[model samples]
Target: MISVVIPVHNEEKNIEPLFREIVAALEPLGEPFEVLFVNDGSTDGTAEVLRRLKERDSRVRVLTMDRNRGEAAALTAGFFHARGEIVASMDGDGQNDPAYLPEMIRRLREGGYAVVSGWRMKRKEPLLTRRLPSWIANRIIGLVTGLRVHDNGCSLKVYRAEVVKRVQIPHGFHRFIPAIFGVKNHEVAEVRILDRPRRFGRTHYGLKRTFEVLRELLTIRFVLGNRVFYEKALLAGGLISGLLAVISLLSSHRPFWAPGAFLGGSFLFFFVWHNLRRFNQAQKEGVFHVRELEI
Candidate 1:
């Protein structure tokens, strides 16, 4: 069985089309599957649309968030309720191809991969707004996380249920799940998927999302940050904190401010150092598993 989890944000119009295509893609496989749609506080008619979908198809289960919690949270909610041995996720805007799912599942099962991610080699979005930032961000994330997947931003990804259990996703971590999975040495495979122009709903991407992605990437790096990383962090923090403390000490107007800044920075430095030590000693759990359940 496979659990398909899709997170939708103000994508009411896309619901039916995506559902049909998903069904078309899965029907030939002749396997039991469930489609879980996580509605992230869609202010539009998305919730009502999903209700109609659920009524029409028993496999369609809608998880509604009271407020717009973002994709990562929605994904988390869907993940918890997914009852399949294999879990898959994709965008709700109908851009991702459901036909690739069978192949992805095959790669995960036969190719001995814990996760299979889709790559949109040819994106349809504009260069400056979508492609450019994705290209740069993918490179940066690849360098930082040391995972070699070509397209980290692509949402079409499949994870072995056990492998996904080991992953911890927070806000904004949706774009970097591959790297996060690599933390425990889980093997990841990438497959090419078709990217289509959205038939409905405006894109949620903007300058703000780019900045948010950058911040999340840094957070991932920090979580995966090692001894060497912390060493550099300590050195940088020490120097910056020391300089700020010293330079501000000379400021006769705000003399106490320097000490406070120094204290704050020192606390941060030691905190990272502490984490490094504890992380180094912690044992890494091997692949995990859960018994199959009815969807």
Candidate 2:
């Protein structure tokens, strides 16, 4: 069984076509599948369309939140409700191709991939706003998290049901899901997917959202880089301690080596303090309480 999760926000016009395409693409696979439409408080006719679709097809399920809780929350709901052996997520803006499902499933099975991410090598978005920021973000993320995925913003990603069963996702951290699992020793693979120009509503993202994603990216990187940072801290502490021991043993006058020992202690203290500041900053912001969930 396979479960497809679609997160939609004000995408009324694209709902029907996306639903039909998913059905057409997945029906021929000769396996049981379910498509979950997570309506993230869309103000358009999206809710009505989903209700109708669910009434018509038993395989179509809708999880409507009381208000817009962003993509991460929506995806979390879908993941909890999904009951397939393989769980997948895609955007509801009609950009991600449903035709790629077969190949994605095949790769997940054959390659023993815990997560199969879809890479859109050729994008139809603008160069500066979308592509440029995305490119910079991908590179920085690759450098930081050591996950060299080309398209971290791509929504066409599939995960094994067992892998995502107890998974927890923070709001706005949806873009870095692969890296989150990747650094934890999960086997994540990528494959090229068709990126079609969206024919429905306009893009909901803006420069503000991009900046927010970048901030979150840095936080994720810092959290993942803790091991190396701590190792360096420990190495520095050990070397300074050993040097101080030797200096004290060989010193004719205590005053000469005392300053160097003080300096080493200061360096170690400053290094640990700086790293602590970063760790504190990486902590998640604010609090969240679920108002309602129909999952």
Each prediction's total of clashing residue pairs, residues at least 3 apart in sequence or on different chains, is 0, 0
- What is candidate 2's CA lDDT for residue 254? 81
Candidate with best lDDT: 1
Give candidates' CA RMSD values in order: 6.4, 7.7
Kindly list the per-residue Cα lDDT of model 1 for residues 239-281, writing each as its tens digit.
7887777777777777566678786787666555554433333
What local distance difference test score does each model get? 0.77, 0.77
Specify the poorest-scoring 10-residue window by lDDT in model 1: 285-294
| TM-score of each predicted structure versus truth | 0.80, 0.76
Residue-level lDDT tens digits of model 2 in 1-295: 8999998999999999998999898999999999998889889899888888888888888888778878877887788778999998999999998999888999989988888888996788988888888888888877777777878899998888877654356666677777765434358788898789898898987677786675565456544556457545655675666677577767787876675766677565455445434434323332122332332
- Candidate 2: the clashing residue pairs are none
